[model samples]
Target: MDDDIPTRMFYAGRRWQVTDMPTRIRDSVWATEPGTGRGFYGWRFQATDETGESFVFDVYPGAEGWHVHHCYA
Candidate 1:
C-alpha cells in the first residue's frame, strides 16, 4: 500500500563509504578558550603536501603577525 517505499530504497543502494587519507600537517585550533585570557602564545609548523611540495605556517597572538617556517622538497 506504500508506493514511496520503492523510491527510498533506490537511493539507499548507491551510497558509498569514505576512504580518504589524513593530512600530515595535522592542523588544530590553538586559540584562547572562552573565559580564559592565556593560551598558546605562538605556534608554527612546516607542512609537506602529498606531492612533496612544502609550505610553512606561523601563528601568533595579537600584533605578533605570521611568518613562514620554510621547508625543502
Candidate 2:
C-alpha cells in the first residue's frame, strides 16, 4: 500500500499541483459512524498549474471514485 500522502492531482482536465499542505476535512466533535465524519470525510487543498493559475478544491470519494465536491478560484 502506498501510505504516502497525495501532493498533486489531475483536476479540471489540468495538472493541479498542490502548492500548500493538504488538509484533512473533518466534521464537528460529535456524531457517530464513519469515524464521526472525522478524517473519514475528505480533503481540501490549493493547487496551481504551470501558468500559476490556482484554485481551492474540496474532494471526496464516493461509491464510484473520487469526486470533486466544490472548487474556488
Candidate 3:
C-alpha cells in the first residue's frame, strides 16, 4: 500500500502474547504485530490526520510475504 495514504488502523483483538502495548494509546496513531496470543505475528495499525479521516488497517502473513488491507468508512 502507499505509505502516503492517510487512514485509520488498529488491532481487532488481543493480538500477540503481549497484553499491553505502548503504541496503543489515544494520540496521533500506532502500529503493532498481531498474533494468536502465541505463535506467529502480523502487523496492524490505525492512521489518521488532522482532517479526522479513519480507516481500519491490518496486515497478515501471506504465502509469499505480508498482506495488508485498509478499510474505510
Sort the candidates on TM-score, descending order. Answer: 2, 3, 1
Q: What TM-score quantifies how close candidate 2 is to the native fold?
A: 0.71
> Could you tell me every candidate's TM-score relative to the true structure?
0.25, 0.71, 0.29
**Which candidate leads in lDDT?**
2
Q: Is candidate 1 or candidate 2 better by TM-score?
A: 2
How does model 2 fare in lDDT? 0.72
Task: Say which candidate scores most in TM-score.
Answer: 2
lDDT for each candidate structure: 0.31, 0.72, 0.38
lDDT of 1 at 47: 41
- Measured with C-alpha atoms, the lDDT of residue 68 in candidate 3 is 52
Q: Considering lDDT, where higher is better, how would the candidates rank from best to worst?
A: 2, 3, 1
Candidate 3, residues 1-73, lDDT tens digits: the string is 3353222333343232212221212212222433323433444455443455544445555577544544344
Candidate 3: RMSD to truth? 12.2
After TM-score superposition, the amount by which residue 71's alpha carbon in candidate 3 deviates from its true location, in angstroms, is 3.6
For every candidate, C-alpha RMSD to the true structure in Å = 17.1, 3.8, 12.2
Off by over 4 Å in 2: 1-4, 28-40
- Model 3 TM-score on a 0 to 1 scale: 0.29
**Model 3: which residue pairs collide?**
7-47, 8-47, 8-55, 9-45, 9-46, 9-47, 10-45, 16-35
